[model samples]
Target: MKTIHLIVHGHIQGVGFRYFAQTTAQSKKVTGWVKNQEDGTVEAVAQGTENQLQSFVHTLRSGNRYARVEEIKVSEADQDQTYAGFKIIR
Candidate 1:
């Protein structure tokens, strides 16, 4: 199991990116949370198998029909997050 942290940049806010990410994560069986950052970025943490994590990140980058993702910053995250399911944080 691994945790992937992502800071998605570009016009991601107010575009249902968080909800899109949550749905995508759930479909991929990735557990974690996604939220809007103050810096106009979307921050997400996903934990799962390598394949699942990869797919989750892909979905985030591709975004939904409303989003226009410019770039995505990826990094490792602490494995102790232990989220029960994917969610959108306030």
Candidate 2:
């Protein structure tokens, strides 16, 4: 399994980006938690197989109808971290 920490930039906040990430991650069977950052970005940590993570990233790029994702900064995260489900952190 692989874990990645990503920061999504652009028109993400106030646009249901966290819920979008949560739904997409769950659909891809990825375990993660997504939240809105104070800097107007969306941050998430996802754990899954390589394919699953890739697909999840792709979906995140597309975003919801209201979100215009400009960029996503991704990096390898602690592989030891695990989550039971995808969540939208308040």
Best by the TM-score measure: 2
Report how far off residue 30 is in candidate 2 (Å): 0.3
Q: Write the per-residue lDDT of candidate 2 for residues 12-85, one digit (tens) a residue.
A: 99988898898898899999899988999989999999999999999999999999999999999987767999
**Model 2 — which ten-residue stretch has the worst lDDT?**
79-88
Runs off by more than 4 Å, candidate 2: none
lDDT of 2: 0.93
What is the per-residue lDDT of model 1 for residues 12-52, given as tens digits with 9 covering 90 to 100? 89988899999998899999999999999999888999999
TM-score of each: 0.95, 0.97
RMSD of 1: 0.8
| Cα shift from native, residue 40, model 2 (Å) | 0.4
Report the alpha-carbon TM-score of model 2 versus the true structure: 0.97
